[model samples]
Target: MRAILLIDDHAMFREGLVLALTQAAPDFTVHAVSNGSEAIAELEAHSGISVVMMDYYLPDVGGSALLRRLRQARPGIHILVLSASEDPDDVHAALSAGAQGFIHKSASSKTLLEALHGVIEGKQIVPDTYAAIDTNGRRLPQSDDAALLSALTPRQIEVLRLVCDGLRNSEISARLGTSEKTVKAHMTAILAGLGVINRTQAVLIARRAGLFGKPN
Candidate 1:
């Protein structure tokens, strides 16, 4: 049986995941831990760890640093990040740090198990919303201009993303508690920054390039 290590900060989330995964993949032996530090300790105690499902919001250490440390310690261990949503930057950073894949938190138990298996088999899985970025055990972008995504500030990018989602300026302003004019201004800047002509171009660029919902 393949040995899987689970790392998360919340007791309930970790336990729920454990129960779900155990039911789905009965042949796997799962070793659960609460954080990155505990993961290292577990590794020291038991060197047979094969796969690690980690969350980014741990108290002791976040997923990025934890994966980096894990890669340094055990290069063969398959690392997958448990994330709430498809975040471009998070997926990029995790894979850049040597994670094998990303599993969305809201995925069904069966999907999670499948993702674990896929990771074990060395496939980089991305959710439906993030299409531009590709993974080959590491997140290497298809285009270097995609790196310019970081130029826009977080909130500006957030508003621009809503526009890409086809949300009107009024709806965005209401949801974000900002003025319609403010939303329009952000959209203008986003278009200019991306060298796009309009909102349609911006949205297409964002989705095609995996620009939205970067893990914070």
Candidate 2:
């Protein structure tokens, strides 16, 4: 039997998907999971599962990074992404990280099933539309785009730019209309996402890489 795993966060959605798959192919045993980490654990626990259908966004692990890890752990396995995000950069990054197929959650149930069948038939897919933007989801700078832009998310990029402008956590919170803790968390994630040690370094590096130099 060709085995598969379904990874999504919503219980209702997972249950509905499981029902649909089992009804469509009774011989196919579909295991369901809640998030990327659990899906990783499931992959480790279950051998011979040939396909993985997952969402791109998870509370624990983000898209591109998770896709890379999944590919590294299960080379040659077919992976399909179902997401609401249509960010062009995200699409490119997911494909680059080794996702075999991509489909938006907004696709009809029939379309989703067809996409799954297509992947099973060795076809690659992506949404027809998406455009890359800066960390704020604004148009990325035409020139001097930072090397770090590839690493940081739109939210983290916003926080990093504010930090470079010498905004303190409280000031940043007020300016961005976010909580101080949230700003601080973004700062931390910005550093880790950039593979840097601290925010000060993160700002300087982003500026040097030319991402922060662009006008809003």
Candidate 3:
């Protein structure tokens, strides 16, 4: 069984995640800690941990600094940040400091599990939304807009254009003569292709790419 080290400050939330993870993945043994010190201690005590899933905001230390220390302690260990922070700087900092993956706390359990598996397999997983921005929270340069626009299918482009027009999933479904579920799937694909996290980001990127006109 693969060992996982889970570090978060909240006792209740940590316990809840422990229970959820235990039930969801029986093949993994989870070691839980409430702060960065205990996390370091746990890491020193156990050499079998395959992944470290940590919260971004902790009372003991900043996320990026702690990530560096953890990486120093266990070189090449898979580290995944599970935080509620959607800030581009936080995402960039954690990854630059050696985190292999970052998952928003709002993600479903299934998405979390997939991220865990991806990290374990050495994939660098981050939300397209966060990945598309720089550390300063600015969108990436306009030069890549052409490439990004070219990556989408014509149908996905239509869905994205409708999205830029401020259409909801149901509205887009109605406009495209497709089900809401299908529109959601296309939106998901568009987000992944565009390296964005939400409809707003998608619209911004599309506008920058000249795939859609700017709002009045």
* lDDT for predicted candidate 3 compared with the true structure: 0.78
Instruction: Kindly report which residue stretches of model 1 are placed more than 4 angstroms away from their true locations once superposed.
Output: 133-216
Cα lDDT of candidate 1 equals: 0.70
**lDDT (Cα, tens digit) per residue for candidate 1, span 149-186:** 67888997788655543355776798899898988888
lDDT winner, 2 or 3:
3
By lDDT, rank the candidates, best first. 3, 1, 2
The global Cα lDDT (0 to 1) of model 2 is 0.70
Each candidate's TM vs. the true structure?
0.61, 0.58, 0.64
lDDT of each: 0.70, 0.70, 0.78
Clash number for every model?
0, 1, 4
Off by over 4 Å in 2: 130-216
User: Which of the numbered candidates is closest to the native, going by highest lDDT?
Assistant: 3
Task: List clashing residue pairs in candidate 2.
Answer: 135-154
| Candidate 3, 1-216: lDDT as tens digits | 999999998888889999989999999999999999999999999999868999989999759888888877876588889998988777766765667778899888888998888777655667867645655577666567768879999999999766543345776798889999999999899889977666655655665555554311
Write the residue-wise lDDT of candidate 2 on 94-186 in tens digits: 655666577888887788877787666655555533322333444433344365567778888778766654345776798889899998888
Model 2 clash tally, residue pairs: 1
